[model samples]
Target: MIFSRERPFLLVGAGKMGGAMLSGWMAQGIDAAAIVVQDPAPSPEMAALLSRHGIRHVTEVPQGLTAGVVLLAIKPQLMDVVLPGLKPAVGDETLVLSVAAGTPVARFEAAFGPVPIVRAMPNTPAMVGRGITALFPTTRVSAAQRDTVDRLLSAIGTVEWLDSEAQIDLVTAVSGSGPAYVFLLAECLAEAGRKAGLPADLAARLAEATVSGAGELMHRSSEPPATLRRNVTSPNGTTAAALTVLMAEDGLQPLMDAAVAAAARRARELAG
Candidate 1:
């Protein structure tokens, strides 16, 4: 309801995340005609989707038009060049929703001159519509525009709104980069199993299944992760033994704390 079919939804990129969002919008019954995508070289799959939806796809920005929502889904490095071309299409009423990581709201205002902006950090899982995004909106954003952003992002996954833009960098580290960390955990788990004498293929499968199942349980359960861990551990049992090493003084906790901090530091650096 927040999104308007009357006004054009100008999308600057049709890459993975952008394409995923479009897929969601279509599935939710958005009129394909209302969307216009601009990408120099879209993937075959993306091209097919656009064709199927009958959405306009252009390699260049059309001259002198007002877009209701200018969604920027391109790389942050390209913003310097891309924003200039897009500026003409951004009217005072345009709500700019950027999904580019490490890009701040001021960057857009500096280019487009104080249009309503919402900066978001979304992870790779958005391809599967299971991603979690963190959003930071400028003070200029109206309540109705915020609702529009909420509905638009809901297409990808759950959304968390932050009170301050500075918090977005932390979010960039957490949910935005968190999926790779989980994948790395699965890799290490598989390696550990292989080292413990299981066959390589079997070890990988076991590790993958365990991680995925545990993640599902965490999602389904109302209890905290710590409680879930304790629930699985018995006196001097295998799970407890593993937890003893994992929960040691110099263990997973300290390591993970350092990892998250390092990621946050890098996020701030990228923003700069």
Candidate 2:
């Protein structure tokens, strides 16, 4: 499918992730009339917001409603039930993008019959337009279609394209499930602060701000993360003291390696 100002986009689900994409598109001044949202039970906030924007919302896929780009944002487990119903709305010319985890490109190809399929693994931060999405497209997808998907995802956050679908499983283990790891860090840091005698609220606030600020710095800085980390560490200082333990043979390195391995295993299992 060729994406142009004239092409209408269909978002098959309007949950948190889907809503975020719609909001990003609207915020970027994309035409509201060019988008169609389909959800059986869209949130009241979403319903009201879509209504205010004058965008189309349907509880069911309307007959003969052809969309140039169709976003499959529904749960992977529900793809079988959803795709069959959506087949009519999806034309041969439609470019299908699936954000559902573990549902491979072959599944969509089987259902949609060789329609250009781009599978993406987007993190939770996309809800705030600061996420990163890793995309993997089938060989059948045209360069134009790939560019269109890339642009659409880039609106929400950074987009990274992988040369192989095998990398998507690793992407799922990293960025797809990475947010929770960062949140866990915040949790641990907050607990440690409280143990060091800070008030619970202050500890939580400090932890949140520190993590967020560090992440923003890493994003804006030209230096690699290791450089930023080394810059903060001073010989015999508190930061170094902490690093001594964290960088130990059985510390964060081994722990993270094990964690990512487990996550990758789970992703593979889910795909199977």
Candidate 3:
């Protein structure tokens, strides 16, 4: 379902995630002429992409240009300030898809007067076209519109449709913020390696490469992550020795559980 140009796609923000999504869309064969990017100051990379593709770019919502899809990819904190300027561009048939975390569909309905809205949470991995997005559409969104949104979001990566909006917060806590968690793991691994007498640069490279390689392997394999983990562990092996500590009653599991809970709590708080 390549987005057609009945009404142009009015992108609200063209920062990293948005830019990456646009890049993916272009790669997936969406017509660049059917897109309008509204960003006051796109990053250099994004700017270059826009220029290269001849995609329309505006500092603010353009007057008289109708939008088929108003994809809001800005930060949640900026929603209020950005919402008012967007109303004029949205049409009755437009689908409002938001990738901003903690922003509920009600918030958009309040501003747009009962439009079809979707609240989604996509991680930074979208920048590499490997991200997964969780989408929850309002009742106003029809099945056809949902399919359109799915195709659009699929440009970034896989799309998961949620049964309830409440689950968005949990998804946000996990995959939405999961990249940072993985990065921290890499950082910690590097530091531990350095402490164990490896050179800093070599340790950092080893940790990063290992994490990315393992992730790639997992991506290509049909095996479950737990199965892969078990395959890596052997009787009295070095990996098993480390797993013993990590699997302890008060180890990574509890810490991760607490961390995810706190993130979900904060996401709920941010919704208000």
Candidate 4:
């Protein structure tokens, strides 16, 4: 069964990421009344949103209400505080889906006591419904439970499953922290254009447009990135000149390798 149709689900934290997921669910025609949002202090945006949609809003967990699914959207640091209180509300049948970065499946299982747990890493782009999420489900999770999590996550963006728990950290480093890397590329490109004598405003505009357009192209085209690069690179043209520098011995390969590695290391540290 698609989880979107499941009624009376509980969102344990209505922060930015949680709110975004709520918005996506509502956009996809999920009944707002089926959701119960709990936050100590809901943002003005979240409050107004829930009110407008007629969804139940609570400053704390409601008594005598059992949710079909419990979304643990709270920060990782607050898990101990939140999970203990949440145990009562989470029935044995309830599937727990967590979007908290660095929180492991074992931790959730320990707290919730052998419940079906799914740990997901979703990037900031999820706010715009263009994100990619990596999901890792505990061994106890049923195929139906996994599908339910996938359906809910897919409402916001694309979803992929990882076989190994260790891959979750790599996924966090890649797609989770990947947006910042792309933004940094835009920053570098704009600054390089300004240094090469373009006006600041024009340089920024060009850099933004170029990056956005290239991304759109990749999304629409069937060709691989290497093929796309070769398509625009003439035998002795400006594109080729730039490629020579970027693909050289001291260029992108080593830089990106180090950057991803650092992010993966940081993810491991966060897990601890």
Determine the C-alpha RMSD for candidate 1 after optimal superposition of all C-alphas. Answer: 1.4
Cα lDDT of candidate 1 equals: 0.87
User: In candidate 3, what residue range of length 10 has the lowest lDDT sum?
Assistant: 1-10
Q: TM-scores of all models?
A: 0.96, 0.95, 0.97, 0.94
**Each model's C-alpha lDDT?**
0.87, 0.87, 0.90, 0.85
Q: Per-prediction count of colliding residue pairs?
A: 0, 0, 0, 0
In candidate 3, the residue pairs with backbone N, CA or C atoms under 3 Å apart (3 or more residues apart, or in different chains) clash, namely none
Task: Give the top-scoring candidate (lDDT).
Answer: 3
Model 2, range 1-272, lDDT digits (tens) per residue?
Answer: 25433556889999988888888888888788888888999999889879989998997887877778989888877887899988887778788988888888888888989788889999889888899999998887888888888888888999999998889889988998999999999999999999999999999999999999999999899999999999999989999999999999999989899898999998888778
Q: Identify the runs in model 3 with alpha carbons over 4 angstroms from their true place.
A: 1-6
Question: Ten-residue segment with the worst summed lDDT in candidate 1?
Answer: 1-10
Better of 2 and 4 by lDDT: 2
Q: Please give me the total number of clashing residue pairs in predicted model 3.
A: 0
Error of 4 at 14 (Å): 2.3
Worst 10 residues of 4 by lDDT: 1-10
Question: Candidate 1 versus the native: TM-score?
Answer: 0.96
